[model samples]
Target: MTELNDQALLRYSRHILLPEIDIEGQTRLLNARALIVGAGGLGSPVALYLASAGVGTLTVVDDDVVELTNLQRQIAHDSASLGHGKAESAARRMRAMNPDIRVVPLAERLEGARLAELVAAHDLVLDCSDNFATRHAVNRAAVVARVPLVSGAAVRFSGQLAVFDPRVETSPCYHCLFPEEGEATDGPCATFGVLSPLVGVIGSLQAVEAVKLLAGIGPSLGRLTLYDALSGDIRQMRVPRDPGCPVCGERR
Candidate 1:
C-alpha cells in the first residue's frame, strides 16, 4: 500500500482517525477503483461521496443529458449543466470536490462485452440505473468478473439498497434476489414522482457499502435494505443465493 502523503493525511484525517478505517483503510480507499452505472439521482451522491472519500479512480456512466426535471434530485448537475451529458456533468463536480482522484466519464449506454470488460477492470461496481435491464446487465457483469456490486433504487417514496459480493462464497447476486424473468413495471422518477432526497438516502448508503468493500471492512452482503421515505421506516432482510440462478448459480 502506498503511504499517505502529508496533504492526504490532513484531507482524510477524519477517516484516518477511525479505528475501523485508520491510515491503512484510508490507503485502500485511495487505491480503489469504482464504477458507477448512472449519473442521475442515485449516481450523484455515490459519485460525490466516493470521490470525496478518495477512491483513486471513478468511472461514471450515463447516456442521458441533464434536463430541467433532474435538478430536483440530481445534485451533481446544476442549471449550467442543462443539456450537457450526465456522465460528464457528474465527473466535473466530482473532480471539483476531490482533485486528488481520477474521474472517467463515459457518456454512453453500456452493455454486452463492453460492460463486462469495464466491470472486470474495476474493484467494485455500483448500480444506480433506474431500469431493470441495466441492473440485470450490471449484475451479470459483476458476477462474471467476481467484483463486488452495490445496488440501489428509489422511486416515489420507496427506496432499496443491496450489496452483492461475488467474492463471497455465500453472498447472493442481484439476480438471486430479483430474477430477470420476474421483472415488474419499472420507469424513471418522472413517471412515479419520486420525493427529493429519497435517492440521496439510498445512494449515500450505496457509497458506504462501496467504501467498506473497498477498504476490506465488513460489507452488508447477503441482505437487502429497504427504506420507506413516507413512513420513515428502515428494514433489512436476508437474501440467499440461488442454486439455479442463471447468472451466478451452480448450474452455470
Candidate 2:
C-alpha cells in the first residue's frame, strides 16, 4: 500500500499520531496478513482490535459453533449467532466493525496437513486455541513456515503471552517452555471457569504485539509475559531455546 491517504490518516488519527506508529507503520499494518487459529475468548478481542486497527487480511479458523455458554467471554458472537459456526460468526462481527479489512472465515478444524497449508499462507499466526494439541500444531506450522507466531492463553485469573519466531536464530518456541504435552487438563472455560475480561486483556495484548511485529514498531514478546488478574501482578522471563525440542529443535 502507498502512503496513507488523507481519509486514512484521518481515520487512524490516533494511531498515526503515535510516534511509534506513524503513517508508514499504519501502511505496513495494512499490507500484512494474520491467521488466528481459534475464534474463542482470546480470539474475540484479538480479532476485534486487529480489524479495527486495520490489519489488511485476517483469516479466522474454528470448527466450533457458538454455544450459550460462550457469551460469557466470546464477544464476537451474539445470541443471534447461537449454534452458528464460530469462524463465520466472528468474521461477520469483524467485518461489521471494520469493512475496510478483508476477513475470511474457515469453518473447519485445522489439523494434520490443513493446518500447515493455512499457516504457510499468512504473514503471521496467532495461537488463541485453548488446548495444548492445537497450540502445538500451530507452533509446528509456524516454525516450519518460518513465520512469527503470537501465542496467548488465559484461564481463571491467569494469562500468558509469547512470540515464537523461529526465523530469528535466538528465539525460543512454545515447546521450549512446555516441553511435553503432559496429561490433558480439565481447565476449559466451561470447567475451571475464567474471568470474562481476563481473556480480553491477554487477547488485546496479543493483537498489539502482532501489529507491532508487522509494523516494525516495537519489540515483540519473544519470551513469555505472565499475568495474574487476581493479584494484578505481571512478570516477564526469557524462554531459552531447546536444542532437542520436537517442534523447533534439531528436526528442522
Candidate 3:
C-alpha cells in the first residue's frame, strides 16, 4: 500500500478517524480503482462521492452529452457543460473536487469485448445506467471478471440498490435477481418524470457499498434494497443465486 502523504492524511482525516475505516482502510481507498458506467443522474452522486472519498482512479463511461433536460437530476453537469459529453463533464467535476485522484472519461458506448476488458481492469464496477440493455451488459462483464458490482436505478419516485460480489460463493449476481429474459420495458426519467432526489438516494448508497468493498469491509451482498420515495418506505429483499442462472450459474 502506498503511504499517505501529510496532505492526504489531512484531506481524509474524517474517514481515517473512523475505527471501521482507519488509516489502513483509507489507504485502500487511495489505491482503489473504480469503474462507473453512465454519468447521468445516479452516476453523478456515485462519481462525486467516490472521488471525494479519495478513490485513487475512476473511469467514467458514457456516450451521451449534456442537454438542458439533464440539468434537473444530473448534478455533475452545469450550464457551462451544456452540449458536452456526460462522461467528460462528470470527470471534470470529480477532478475539480479531488485533484489527488485520477479520473478517466470515456465518451463512448461500451459493448462486447471492450466492455469486458474495462471491467476486468477495475477493482469495482458501479452500474448507474438507466436502460436494461446496458445494465445487463455491465453485469455480465462484472460477473465474468469476478469484480464486485454496485448496481443502482431510480425512476418515477422508485429507487433500487444492490451489490453483487462474484468472489462470494453465495452472493447473487445481477442476472440472478433480474433475469435478462424477463427484462421489462425501460422506463427512463425522460419518459416517466422522476423525482430529482431519487437518484441521489440510490447513488449515494452505491458509493457507500463501493467504498466498503474497496476497504475490505463487509458489503450488503445477496440482498436488494428498495426505496419508495412516494410512501417514504425502505425495504430489503434477500436474493438467492440461481444454480441455473446463465450468467453466473454452474450451467453457464
Candidate 4:
C-alpha cells in the first residue's frame, strides 16, 4: 500500500472522516485497479468519479471516437476532442483532473481474448458498454476471473444497475437476466435521446459500488436496481442464479 502523506490525507479528508472509509479504506481505494469497458455517457462519469476519488488505476476501453452528438452526455469529451478516440479523451480528462491516478487508454473495442486478458488483470470490472454482447462477454470474463462486476446501463429515461460477483455463491450474472441474444433494440440512446444527467446518476452509482467492493465496506446490491428518471422511482429485484445457466453454472 502506498503511504499517505499530509497532502494525500487532505485530498481524501472527507473519505477519511467516514467510519466506513477511513485512512485504511482510502488506501485500499488508492491501491485498487478498475477496468471500465466503455467511454461513453455511463462510462464517462464512472471513470471521472473513480479517478477523482483516488482509485489507484483505471483502464478505459472503447473503439469509438468523439462526435458532436456525444457532447450531450459524454462529459469526459469536449469540443476539443471532437474526433479523438473516446478512451484517449477520457484518459486525458481523468489524468488532468487527478494526476495521481494511472489512466490507461485502449483505443479498440474489447472482445474475445482481449477482454479476458484485461478482465484478469483488474481487481474489478465495470460494464459500461452500450451493447449486450460486450456486457455478456464482460460478465463471463469477470466470472472466470472471480472478480466483482459492476454493471450499469442508461437509455432514454431509465437506468439499471447490478453487481455480479461469482465469488459469492447465488449471485446472478448479467446473462441470468437476459438469457438469449435479443435483437438489437431500435433507437439506442443516441437515436432516441436521453436525459443527460440520468447517465451521470447511474454512472456515479456504479463507481460507488466499485469502491465499496474494493474496500469491503457497505452492501452492494447483488441483484438488479432500476431507476426511472422519468417517473422518479427506484426498484430493486433479487435475481437468483440459474443452476443450469451456461455462463457460471455447472454442467448437467
Candidate 5:
C-alpha cells in the first residue's frame, strides 16, 4: 500500500476512524483496484460509492450510450450526457467526485479471452450488467482468475445481491445458482418497467461488499439476498457450491 498524504488522510478520515478499518485498511483501500461491468442503473451507485470511498483505480466497461430513458435510474449520467457513452459518462462523474483516484472508461463490450484478461488485472470485480449473458461470462472469468465478485440485479419491483469469492473453496459461483440456459430469462427494464429506487438499494449493497472485500473486514455475504420492493420484505437464501456445476465444480 502506498503512503497517504495529508489530504488523502483527511479525505478518508471517516474510514480510518473505524476500528475495523484503521490506517492500515484505509491504505489498502487507497491502493486497491476495482473493475465495474456495465454503467447503467446498478453501475451508477456502485461506481459512485467506490470512487467516493477512494478506491485507487477503477475500470468501467459498457457499450451503451446514455438515452433519455436511462436518466430515470442511472444517476451517473444526466441530461447533459445524453447520447454520450455510459462508460465515459460514469467515468467522468467518478473523476469529478474524487480526482485522487484513476478512472478508466471502456466503451467496448468485453467477451471471451479479453474479458478474462481484464478480470485478472483487478483486485475485485462488480457485476452490474443487465443481461444474464454478461453476468454469466463475468462469473466464469472470476472463477478462472480466482477474483472476488460482487453481483447485483434489479428488475421491476425485485432486486438480488450476492458476494461470490472464487478464492474460497465452498462459495458458489453465479452459474451455480442460475444455470446457463435453465434459469435464464429475458426481463429487461424496457420489457417490464423497473422501480428506480430498487436498483439503488441493490447497487449500494454491491459497493458495500466491494469495500468489505478490499478492506479485509466485515463478513462476506456467502448467501443471496432477495428484496421485494412492493412487499417491503427481504429474504436470504444459502448458495451452496454445486459439485456438478461446470464453472466452479472442476475446481472442487
Candidate 6:
C-alpha cells in the first residue's frame, strides 16, 4: 500500500538488484494480488514463492484436507497439519515465510458465480488443481474474468506449465488449447505415484512465470512448456487462440 520501507528494501535487496526488476518492479510485486486455485503440489511452490516475493495479497482456494499420503509432494503440510484444510495449511506456511502480505484461505470448493467472483477480484489466477473438472471450471472463471492464469500439472515423471493472459488479444485461453470435450487423463499422485520433486520443478516454474508476469521481468505468455523428469528434457510450443472455439474465441 505504501512505498517500500527500509526494512522491506533490505529484505528484497537481492531481487531489487536484478537489472530487470529494480525498485519499480518490486513495488508492483508489493501491490499485486493473486488467486491460487489449489493448495497442493503445484500450489505449494507457487504459494511459497509468491509470498516470499512479497505479493501484497494472495487468495488460496481449496476444499480438500491434508492426508498422510499427501506428504510425499505437498510440502506445505506435514504430520502436524494432517486433516487441516489445504488452503489454510498453505496459508500458514506463507505467513510463516513472509508476514508482510495478506493470505486468504478459502476452505471451500470454488464453483458457479463464486469462482468467477474470486477470479475477478484478483490480478492473476494460478490453477494447481489435479482434476480436469476443476481445471475447466477455473478456466471458465478466468476467461470470464479476463485475468491472467498460470496453470501447472504433474503426474508420474512428467509435468506441464501454461500461462494464459486474457490481457493479450491473441493469447490462447485454457480452452483454446484443450476444449471442454477433450479427453481427460487425470490421475492423482496418490493413485499413479509421482516423483517427489516433479511438482517442485513444475511449481517452481509456475512461480517463475507468475513472478515474471507480475514484475514485468521476463516472457510469460502464449506458450506451453512440458518437462520430462525421466529424460531430463524440456520442450516448449506456441499456443495460439482458437478462433472457432468457445471461451475467449472471437465468437464469444
Taking all chains together, each candidate's TM-score versus the true structure is 0.98, 0.94, 0.98, 0.95, 0.98, 0.96
Overlapping backbone residue pairs in candidate 4 total: 0
Model 4, residue 93: displacement in angstroms? 1.1
Model 5, residue pairs in steric clash: none
Give residue 17's error in model 6 in angstroms: 0.2
**What is candidate 6's lDDT per residue for 1-252, written digit by digit as tens?**
557999889989999999799988899999999999999999999999999999889999989999998898889888999988999999999999999899999999999999999999998899999988888899888888888899999999999999988777778888888787887567788788899899999999998888888888655678889999999999999988888767787534
True-vs-predicted CA distance for residue 106, candidate 5, Å: 0.3
lDDT of 4: 0.88
Task: Give per-residue CA lDDT, model 5, range 105-196, as digits (tens).
Answer: 99999999999999999999999998888899999999999999999999999999999988888899998889997956846798899999
lDDT (0-100) at residue 109 of candidate 6?
91
Q: Which residue pairs show backbone clashes in model 2?
A: none
Tell me the deviation in Å of residue 179 in model 5.
Answer: 0.8
TM-score of 3: 0.98
Q: What's the lDDT for residue 86 in model 6?
A: 94
- Model 5 scores worst on lDDT over the 10 consecutive residues at 181-190
Candidate 1 positional error at 122, Å: 0.3
Q: What does candidate 3's lDDT look like per residue over 1-252, in tens digits?
A: 687999999999999989999999999999999999999999999999999999999999999999999999999999999999999999999999999999999999999999999999999999999989999999999989999999999999899999999989998898888888884666788898899999989999999999999988999989999999999999999999998898999623
C-alpha lDDT score of every prediction, in listed order: 0.93, 0.88, 0.94, 0.88, 0.92, 0.89
Any runs in candidate 6 off by more than 4 Å, and if so which? none
> Lowest-scoring 10 consecutive residues by lDDT in candidate 4?
179-188
If ranked by lDDT, best first, what sequence of candidates would result?
3, 1, 5, 6, 2, 4
Candidate 2 TM-score to native = 0.94
Residue-level lDDT of model 2, residues 1-252, one tens digit each, is 556667777878899898888888899988889999899999999999999998889999999999999999999989999999999999999999888889999999898799999999999999999988788888888989898899999999999999888778778888788765655453578777999999999999999899898888655645789999999999998888888787888644
**Residue-wise C-alpha lDDT for candidate 4, range 209-245, written one tens digit per residue:** 9989887786465578999998999999988888878
Off by over 4 Å in 5: none
